[model samples]
Target: MMNIRRAKPSDKDFVLDFCMNTFEWGDYVYRVWDRWISDPSGLLLVYDSSNFPSTSKSIPLGIIHIVKCLGDILWLEGLRVNKIHRNKGIATALLKYSLNYGINNGIKESSALVSTNNFPSQKMLEKLGFSKFLEYRYYNINLKKYRDDCNVSIKPDLVFSKKLDIKISQFRDIFSIQEYLSNPEISKFCVSKYFDSWRLYDLNTSLSSLSSFVRNKELLIIVNDIDEIVGIAIVKPSGKISFNGMPMIQISYLNCLNLSIFVRVIHLLLMNYCDVNLFNNAHFLLPVFAELEKILSTKSIENSDRFFLYSKFLDTTSNLSSILPANLQ
Candidate 1:
C-alpha cells in the first residue's frame, strides 16, 4: 500500500539518499530540503512505500515540492523518484497530488521548468495538461575568463563608473521600477518570471511586488548618457554553491534595448557584481530571441542548456481524476 504524506524531518535521510545522484554534477535537493519542509506557503511531499510487503521499515520512494508564487501561481519543482522505483508512476502520482493540493488552496495556475532534453518529463507534463509557455536558455559566464578576455578591471567602484555611453547603477525606488516595467515595449521583452533564492516567481511589477527586490538591493538599471533606463538586471545568490567552493550568483532577469548596452552591462557585471574570487560563475536565462542569440554568440559566451516553462490552468470545478494514472485513480 503506497501512500503520500507531508514530509517530516525523519524522511531527510531517505530523500537525500535517492537525490544524491539525480544529475551528472549532483543535486540541490539536500540544500533546499530544510527550507522547503519549513516553508509555510509551500508543501513538500514524500512517497511512502514502507507498507509494501517487500519493505521492512519506513521507505520513501519519491518526493515533490510546490510553493505559491506571486498572485495565484503555484511553482512546482524538485520532483525526484528513487532510482529503483522509476517508471512505476511515482512521479505522476506525486504531481497529481500536488495539483490537487493547489486547487484546494485557490491556486489559479501552475508552472514548472524542465530541461529541454528531458523528453520523458515533457511527455508526462503534456499528459497532465500543461502547455509549453516559453523557452529559456542558460548562459554560464566564467568571471575570470570574461574579465581577462575583455581586459576589464574588477573594481567594486566600477559599478558606477562611466564607460562609453552607459553606466550601471543599483535601483532602489520600487515605484520607478514598477512604472518602467509597465511600459509595453519593455514588458514584451521581459520574461514573466524572476528568481529569488533559487525559487522562481511570477514577475509582479506592483509596488508591493517590486519592493522586496528594492529592499534587498538586488535590482540594477543600465542608464545611457541621458540617464534613461535602457536595461535592467536582477541578481540573486543561487541556492546551490559552485563546485569550486565559491558562491554562485544568478542574473535572474536581464533586458537591454540594444546589443551595445547589453554587452556593456554584461562586462560591468562580470567586473563588478561577480567577483572572480568570490563567485565561480554567473548564469542567466534569456528568451529565445534572435537578436539576443546573435549578441551572445558574437561575444563568445557559453550557453549551457535550454529549458521549457510549462504551465496549466487549474479549474476548481473540473475533475482531477484524469491527472493520476488509471491504476492510481
Candidate 2:
C-alpha cells in the first residue's frame, strides 16, 4: 500500500533531500526547489509501502510540485522518484493519484515538460496519460555582455517607472493588466496571466521571487492621435526568475499606444527593476517574440527562455496526460 497525502510543512526538507539525492538539475535549481513552499498554488508528496525494504528511514518515494490559476489547468513539476526505488511502482502510483486528484478537484487539464533525452521519464508520463503538444527551445543573453541593444524610445502618454517610488492607488493609478485584457485589442496581445502581476517579486522577499519586478510592476499606457490606447511595453532590469528554475526578466510597463487622460499606477515594487543580480521574463506579443529577438539580438538582452501563451484543455477525454495541473495539486 502507498500513502499519498498533502505534504506537511515538516516534509519540506525531506522533499528537497529526496529530489537532490535522486536527480540532476544543475546546482542552482537544486537549492531553489525547497523554496517552492511559498507558492499559493499547490505541491504534493509520494511515499511507498513496505516495498522499499528500508529500516531506519521514512524516505519519500517521490515528490511533485503544482501551480494553478483561475482556470481548470494545473502544472506538474519536479517529479522525482528516489534512485533506490526506481523499479518499483512508486512513480506509477504517484501519477495515478495526481490524475485522480485532478478530476476530483475540478481540474480539466494537467501537464508538464520533459527533455528530449529523458526517455524513461517521457515513456512514464505518456503511459500515465500525457501527450506532447509543443517543443520549447531555451536561450539566454548576458546583460553586461550586450547592453547596447534596447532601442525603443517612442514613449507613451504615460510611463510607469521601473522604480515603484510613487504611491498611486486608484484604478487610474494602479491598473491591473488582467483587468485590461478584456479589451479586444489588448486581449489579442496578452500572452501572460491576469494574476501573474500578483506573483511578482515586489510582493515577495526572496531573491528567487524577485526579478525585474522593479521594472514591469509599473504599468505604462500609450495612446493614438485620438487618445485610444494602442501599445504597452515594460522595462525590467536584466535578470531572471521562473516558477522552479527557469530564467526570466523583470520588465516594467513602458509605452502604451493610446487612450489615456487617466492615471496609471502600481501597488508595490521598485528595489531594482534593472538590478543585474536577478533574472526576469519580460514578454512580447507571442508573434512579436521572433521579431523582438532579432531586434534584441542586435543589442544585449539575453534570450534564454520560451514564453508560452500557456493554455490547457479539459474534458472527459482531454489532454489528461501531458499537463502539469496545480489543481491536481
Query: What are the runs in model 2 whose C-alpha is more than 4 Å off?
Result: 9-14, 18-35, 38-41, 48-50, 54-56, 87-89, 114-122, 134-140, 148-248, 251-329
Off by over 4 Å in 1: 151-179, 238-245, 275-278, 290-303, 322-329
For residues 1-329, could you state the per-residue lDDT of candidate 2 as single tens digits?
Answer: 35665555666565566555443433232544545655656655555334455646565667666655444567666677767667776777676667656665667777665655577877787776577654343334444333222224313222343322332222332233333433565434333322232121112213332233323444444333454444444443323335244455444233231223212321112112234445433332122223334434433444344422222344554433443434323
**Clashes (candidate 2):** 63
> Could you give me the TM-score of model 2 versus the true structure?
0.54
Candidate 1 local lDDT, 103-170, one digit each (tens): 86778999998998999999999999999988877777666565564454435333444643323333
List the lowest-lDDT window of 10 residues for candidate 1. 290-299
Best model number under lDDT: 1
Q: Please, what is the whole-model Cα lDDT of each candidate in the order they appear?
A: 0.72, 0.45
